[model samples]
Target: MKNIKLYQVFLALLGLIAILLTISLFIPEEGIRVFGMNLKFPTIGRLMHPKKQETAEIDNIIVDVDTTFADPLLQHQNGSNGDMGAPNAGELSVKNSTIIHLNDAGLVNLHNFFEKLSSAATAKKKVHILHYGDSQIEGDRMTGFIRERLQNQFGGNGPGLVPANNVYNTFAFVQTYSPNFKRYTCFGGDKLNSRKYGVMGSAARFTREYKDSAEIANETSIKTGWIELAASGSAFGRSRSFSTVKMYYNSCIKPCAINVYENGALIHQDSLKADGKSHIFKLTFPGTPGKLKFEFSTAISPTISNFTLEGDYGVQMSNIGMRGSSGTIFGSMDRGVVAEAMNDLGVELIIMQYGGNSVPFFKDSASVRNYASYFKGQLNSLKSMRPSAAIVVIGPSDMSRMVDGIYETYPFLPYCVEQMKKVSMEAGAGYWDLYGAMGGKNSMPAWVNKGLAGNDYIHFSNGGARVAAQLFYDALIAEYVKWSGKGE
Candidate 1:
């Protein structure tokens, strides 16, 4: 009886194992779903939605008219005879046409801004455009493209912003370093404060301390005629400490003293000092337009904050990227300092690209609205400071969320975009529908599948970024044309 019982138990156990294997085989690779409605697995259910197309229509009016105006004639063919041969005649006519169009209007407006920027360049006027964004610009990809395009169109030169040392490894065009000094950026929490300067606005303290050698050198060559030093904070000391630092320029020559060069010609030279305060230094070199360079070495290691160089009249794109920033820290920065910087740079446009970092934590419409309110306050503060700069707020892109055992659009993304748009308009800033531009709801799957966007979906790939930048630029151009009466 015992042997029989043992045999039956073994058979039961084997049968149970076979049943479990069968169930496993039937499960979906992503995961088993009760009704194919729960998207909880990555890369699955990405096809659940169809592509969305965002379109807008606007009417353009044109008119036709004929008119005549008087003109002074210097002389007539029959003056000596009796009648002058047909007194000098002048005529005027106007033509108008009505047209309807569909496009990313915002991008068209941006293109108009660039057109004006190009005109400024042609006239040899200094044009400054501030491109403030998040990590998308941290690598300088989008900004670089716009800068190159503008410069090529308008005759400007050089990379715009050069920090004392590059803290991020993502910068592809330029490299930076400071001897005998370790650098900490706001990106890593190694340094955090209310005065954190980022792609959006200026910061307060760019703290630095000298170790051992006590001297720092920034090695990037300036390819423009002007260099603007940007810094802030009263915490480093009052006036005396801030006023006592010296800047130099080093070449193959012996003078090695502080010298400013324009187009390879010497312009000015000065001596060194060791005061411990922060201030902006403006260096202008004279000659035919060309590249310039500034070398800094002080008795004490000075904290060099921000550097911008450009033509007299071309767009100046400045990126203040704070990694991990939720875009909620703008109100914390010293507004006075930031305003001053904006004014000095002649900043005409400001772009705020954020929201990705906050997407994961978004829960409901109320929470999103609260965040938008905070963003509005930040914009309001900026407007109060630099009342002249045009502001454009870029909403976050689509982020993936698991649903029905597969990845899909985050449930609240559309709500978030709507909230941001409302806040932006309320703050008197123009809002760019990045979400809409990306083709609306659950569009990331299509973008990634088409290889236009990255797999992450939240952030764009290089090609994706270029497309986004172009869209924004085009929108701006369209608006500018309408404002300037350049479009028929």
Candidate 2:
């Protein structure tokens, strides 16, 4: 009986708690009300309500300038002896407003080249401009734009730069697909100790050895030009295999013979050279408009270093990029082989864009100076190999990092730029301040925020890359104009 009474008391308390909870749900807490219901506070409404609404006024007006001079004395006071403020300095001198023009140092020689090139073009001689740089020039962004402009002003046909193996194809507007051989690049570790074909060029050594009676079919058709075959020591031991080489135009016809169609008449059948030494082969026809097919079969496997099919006078630009290269790897390559290859290609200009990789590793100015000295020596060696080529040095662009939760320029950026400039001057090369052109220190924030540059603040976005390429091109063109006495 006692246990039953305890249980009943507990049940009574639970029922009372449930009733309290139900009442709490409906009651509003200070100024809170149920959804879609209005709370009327009669006491506050009568005290706060206004008797009438007030209105504000706005005025609009128009005014015109008076032609008649009212203050002759004031005008006389402002006049400066009829000098017109020293002739208004005549449009700020094209030199001051534009950053595109060459500095005083690079004007003389560059101008002479332009003049000679112009003269050669007028004479219908194929004048060539070789633009070589780092990864920036790889896909022909800068080179293509400059080529189009120059070719429009000058005269040229078709795109330059032969389709080479191991190309960054995605970035290229032109495409190349080859078979019978695999492609490798220095960027990959296939060749450990390779030769940098001199400033004029570099030799790319292949791991694939040539076989006797090896036939390689390049599936590309020549649409606009003739091809040339050249060899270098890069293919050191493979030269003896290729004694007889045959080129077939249209594989549908077997045992292809060289047909001479001069003036729409079959003049003669010239025997094509089966003996392959690195020499030029001019396949002449009746100038008929048709796609050219070439089939190369050799009795002996000929070792080829470089082959170029050139059409018209134009510039061929190539970019070789190594993410962390310090511009010191040239000495590690096969100098003789590289020199031979570069000479055959006729490389004229070399642009070295580096310095970012060296920043974090270098400590002080003395250390930088030592690196610069070493770099200068390397440049001297390159010059020795390719004596005729002109070299240009581009400094690193502005790079930034976070400081106390805010973005800021890298502490060592200025130092890096300064060291690079010193090295360039010592090496007898022209230097362009990429940082300055990028609006100098603290400019990275603006660039990244405005989407002009990448979030890394180092590499450029596509638009940024285009703008950067344009800047460099403009500078070159400006230098050309100033030197050639050609005004825009």
Candidate 3:
């Protein structure tokens, strides 16, 4: 009886739909009025065919962002170089996205930093800007674009700082090494016991770690290690043209003679000081040397802090990509060594990209606030190390995780962003809302579907990174314009 009733009810619904279709077909375009308002019905032709609703594209979904920044492509075409190319970093038109919040002191610091950039060439000192981030920036994805644009526009050259035995295979520069080289990092599982990881927060060694002077004196044979370097085939023009090479090391007990060879023949030779303090050795080539090889002969290897390729003046921006960090490790490092390294490099700006690594462990709003507070402490520590440097903290980009069988934005992420910005402002640092700029909550799904982000929905693709970086660049240029009273 129940089955019969369900079938009858289904038939009645079908009959009702048919009746409505026939009535709609018979009804005129101006239907019979039932009240003061006129009624309308679909015509036979209209009833037969219906229009479809179109889905909006990625740009269409971007809401509440200031889209006034000149289209990067079109802006590049207006370059004064006569030939069509992109303008320099500071040459963009109109304000970009709005900064979440920055206190008055932070604005003053930014202005001071801009002064440094503008007068760096006149002063004959290069402004070193350290971009610290997680794996998203590893291998020079987003930072590469920023570096290229800044170097071309501002006065920087060379890929900022390439590790001696690079762990990440970055295309901006190429380096190959002998098998004996070992690496240790403060951020990794195989960290140094001394906790003396310098400004780069990592070190590379060609031989065993130095323990005592006796070990170096009793050495039987000189340890030989080598690294061959060549600019990659697709390297950016600015990154490839470097005239200076600076080697940083510390805790040396044995004098190491380093030979710089071009192809088969040695072009230069220098010896490392057997001192127990940090030191930087600089060598300037007559021109951009070709296919250089650095051969080391040392009985006791010092910690190889960093190897930097740079020009004579302007800016030097280094990407310090730590794989899994919450932006809270600065206080744990040897403060004197880090400060000396920054001073040596003339660091004036520190752009810290973090909060992504901390988002996964955020169980609630309190956790988010706590992490932000902890991050503020690290920022304070960094400021102490580089007292004159201005800091900018870029909050995490949109990240999604599988939640209840559907990929969705992680909960408390906005809270995390809120707390981060609050603390950064309190710490007198500028904060960029990467999450908001990329589109807010659940935007990762759209970015992933549009090929702007990877399948993991946590990282941006190369194309997306370019967009992200451009947004940031525009923000900086816009504020800089406001500060300088130019670029109207």
Candidate 4:
């Protein structure tokens, strides 16, 4: 009788295991809602196929940066003598800090943009560099450092293009917008059905989207909105001084009254054109104002794309940070609106830093390749939109995830990096291996321990961002110096 009871217990345990497996297989990552509460179970993907573990816990990490990739191309452009030849010992040493990979055509594109950046002051025109990335660059973290360095090296001033809503409120400037404004973005949140997100991938408006012309026609109540910009005490010296502000807007069927104020006194006022087309409203100041305010009143709010804070001449880098994006939304955006904005802004280079957000969910080699394919499409679209601008893709950095109580680099991260690099170069864009720059495998734990990165092991802290940005900037300048010397 006791033996029979033991056999029955074993059968019951097996049935329980089968039921749990079935439930786990059906459960998604976001979990399910049960009785107004989120109920979650161990996912079958994680339970069945566990992440591959590292050899051992990393104790001492030595970062070895490969510099050969920095000078990947030496094309004889514009009567330069160096054509696919070896760089000298001095040049190699100067480029030791960079891990940039560029092909022949990419190098040419870089050189052309370098020429424009170098002569911006002499030409009396601003050369814009649009820096687009995920949350890794939000609030102008790395972009701020890069901007300061670029402005100091080349001649430029101001904080570059800022969004109309001023959501991030970067350290470069203090901004505040009224409560009436509503923001629409291309990457996340409630996206616009019109797909008209401009260069910043976002726009602001006081009125909600109207379904038909009748709704817009019936809207007669006038709405008032305002945005204010103030100088930041902690801002870089160059960003603190700007002589001009250009507001980019579109889709206006009614005349909007705009008033610009410096401090408490009204400085300039104008009415927006009633035409429903893209336009730029320019405002120049004799000197830096203490507080700049822009107030608008209209029955229907027009789409405000962005506002430029720049000088008359020099390099201007715009920080466009889109959170939770893998940089794949450009193909869905309005190409014409983006191209128009790019042309108006005098864009010479576009720097795309992405792939971190996709690192965690990458399941296998095929998944990595699939993402790369989609990413390539986005790059191709940008290239088509702005053929004259140089494009560079900064691959994802070292991101870690917890597996069996130990935080280690994601299993497929290295392979994803490899695929992203291949796709970027194939798309006629330069590639920067951020993973290698961050010291490769199992590096995030050390960074987290040092407090350079967040405990999440994905995003970098402010200090770490500066370090990362410096690595990129150093590599860029080193390559430029080599190219400039070759031209001479």
In order, the Cα lDDT scores of the candidates are 0.51, 0.45, 0.77, 0.80
Off by over 4 Å in 3: 1-57, 60-90, 212-217
Candidate 1 residues 83-124, lDDT tens each? Answer: 111112122111222111223543444454455564664454
Model 4 lDDT per residue over 1-488, tens place: 43568879899999999999999889997789999998877789979776665432323322333212222222223321211111111332354455579988888888898898767766667889999999999988888888877776666777888888867747778888889888999888877777777899999988876658888788888899988887677776667767678889888777799999988799888999878788899976655557888899999888888888876567788899999999999977889989999998899999999999998898889999999999999989999899999998999989887755678888899999999999988888889887887778887777777777898888999878877887888778777877778524
Q: Give the poorly placed runs of model 1, Cα more than 4 Å off.
A: 1-119, 152-155, 169-172, 184-188, 192-278, 284-300, 403-405
Candidate 4 deviant stretches above 4 angstroms: 1-95, 486-488
Worst 10 residues of 1 by lDDT: 235-244
lDDT of 2 by residue, 1-488 (tens): 44568879899999997776555545444334559664533233333452232111111100111112122111112322221111101111122212422344444435545664555444543344555445434455445554444444444323333333334532322222235323333333444222322332322221233223322344222212122232222211111011111221111111223343332445445433434323333442221112233223322222223334332333334345544466766666556655554565455656677666665566677777777777777677777767666667777777766643456666777877777777666566667777777777776666666565777766666555655655665566566665556555
Model 2: which residue pairs collide? 195-334, 197-201, 197-202, 197-203, 197-338, 201-342, 241-300, 244-274, 245-274
> Residue by residue across 1-488, what tens digits does model 3's lDDT show?
43568889899999999888887878877577787876776666665765332222457534433323332322222212222222245454555765535799898888889998777655666889999998888877778777776665666667788776688868678888888878888776667666667888888777766556586578857788887876665666667667788888887777788898887798888898887688987877655657888888887677778788877777788888899977788876889999999998899989999999989888888888889889999889989999899999999988888732467778889999989899898888999998888778877878887787999989988777877887887788778777778864
lDDT of 3 at 30: 58
Per-residue error (Å), model 4, residue 295: 0.8
Q: Candidates 1 and 2: which is better by lDDT? A: 1
Every model's TM-score: 0.63, 0.57, 0.81, 0.82
TM-score of 2: 0.57
Model 4 sits at a Cα RMSD from the real structure of 9.4
| Residue 95 local lDDT, model 1 | 23
lDDT of 1: 0.51
